[model samples]
Target: MDFPQQDPAHRTLTVVGGGVIGLTCALAAADAGWRVRVLDAGAGERASWVAGGMLGSLGEGIPGEEASLALSVDSVRRWPALVTRLDDPGVVTATDSLFVAASATDIEYLRHLADFVWADQPGTGAALQPVTGRDIRTLEPSLSSRLVGGYRAVGEWSVDNRRLLEALRATATTAGVELVSARVASLAELDDLGPDAQILLAAGLGTAALWPGADLHPAKGEILRLRRTRWSVPPPGHVVRARLHGRAVYLVPRADGVVVGATHYEAEGVADRVPQAGGVADLLADAIEVLPGLRTYELTEAAAGLRPCTADGLPLVARVDARTVVATGHGRNGIVLAPGTAERVLSILEGVEE
Candidate 1:
């Protein structure tokens, strides 16, 4: 995962965590005139590495989540701009998503989602037009005949999160953000910056141990990556989501392969970051039922990561003092909200808070 080296002067900011959120924040701070260096655990198990990388929050929204949806949409809009800043446009694709229902009961849930969309966001519902089975076939010929109905979320998007993380690291390097690849015990352990230098704790779930006051916890998730085949029936296109058996599953197709996931383990008894056999079985079962072509696709990878979750499903982006900032607790939307979180942090440092 190493890249070509780049050099910069002394550090003015010390950011914890090397995930998307921390790197993006370091990049933003460097661009805003802070000589930055990122302290990273360099641990292999990070939420950004295992995320499904879907920027489609509309499909995930519910009846009482308008506020969260609004923030997520704002973050999605910031992604394209961040890509441009990285000078790498290939990291993102505006592949609007489609949500389908395979059973009669699933159709009711689709209606509920549609109702939630149209409740206040008028144009969102207009974009999410209901489609019959035939219409779905017309849009994506590979879908199975079992899908009864669905709606298209016109402006949603997805990202190759693995690539994005790489680009962020490279960009941070070029911007003079020294990356220290080691685990930091606590914020109090860091002591190199000058009196004016700032400290930002953006360590995701790692913040739970580094800054216990942050109240962060781990939400374990497992995802599967299937190698796409040219001979496959569906030909693998766009983002397809469905709840075949009351469990939510989404498939994101990329240049590398198709990512099928995920199984959420928010209750007790689910081991931290362990990929359960039952979870994998259920994910594969639901994924194959919706996209039958995936049945034959190569199972390239089965991995899991712990999302940095808070009691409330929103990231914490605020200033601790004139010289310290905190930005973590982005459970599932870490990739989507990284850029916005960076912008918010930089704004606060410049005497304005947003």
Candidate 2:
């Protein structure tokens, strides 16, 4: 299924994969006046489908990973402009995120992490403010009263993943980009496009099969989507990330309810997309502990997604061959890194380096 191309005279670019990363790059390329055609197998259990959609540059940062942190901070900063361009302002569900601790041990760990972020990582466009349990409750009363203390990441944002994908597809279509519902098994399949035609491989985990050097692996994660009931407590206005008993859980708000997730593990031997019973149980337990009100909500969906991970924990966004550019291995930060990936891929495609 291919859409009609309105512009035949412009330079053509073919993008493989239709996930957030591929779609985002396609949209950016089309806006740059390229005749973009995206080829995707339309798989339902993709990484983008099961994501929590938190653009957590600050909240998700690690102390030693300075390079990846810088990339995350840079990418998240581009989301505001990208959201405006998509014309779907409602896709942004939360503008801030709060990291809370449910136990005393967790509180100490949270404080150390917060201190590192606040003192060492300065001017990253995100400010970390240490808040007590009372402050967290005042900010979001829906959370559990058992929370001890945590940090409020004033700049983190969350989006409706499904909605964002739809908006990107719609806007890209309107921008004259073609969406083809077919998969390219390998780069050799696209050799007929000739030497000068540009080809971008943004196929998420599938990029490894197309290009042997993508060095991508699948990190499977399970997420639950809960629907709010009439009797349920009002959802938190800010994205809530809770640390309980040495485990981390987050509840991202939706218009209808909340998204609870996710437990990560290696997916090499496990090929199933079914949400593991143990994982789901753990997520539910942690979520209910963080926001006790979630017990009443209906579990509308439970599934697993395979996030494309790399050895170094950084996304691969470089040109591989003369006409081929690879953009995958985004790990868990694909949604957060889409804009920055698009920016860098476009620069590479246009032969411009920064």
Judged by lDDT against the true structure, how good is candidate 2?
0.87
* C-alpha lDDT score of every prediction, in listed order: 0.78, 0.87
Give the per-residue lDDT of model 2 (tens digit) for 199-274: 9899988888888998877898999999999999988899999889899999999989999989989885436577
> In candidate 1, what residue range of length 10 has the lowest lDDT sum?
1-10
How well is each residue in 1-354 modelled by candidate 1, as lDDT tens digits? 111111224337788889999999999988977788898887575789888888866866776767667777777778778888888877764468888888888888888877755446645755677889898888888888998987878777888888889999999999988999888886667755556677888888777676667877677788999987776664356788886857688988777568888877673422366688998998898888878888778898998888877777778887776567789988778887887788888876665663
Name the candidate that leads on lDDT: 2
User: What TM-scores do the predictions have?
Assistant: 0.91, 0.95
lDDT of 1 at 196: 61
- Which residue ranges in model 1 land beyond 4 Å of their true spot? 1-11, 117-119, 267-271
**Candidate 1 Cα RMSD after full superposition onto the native fold (Å):** 5.1
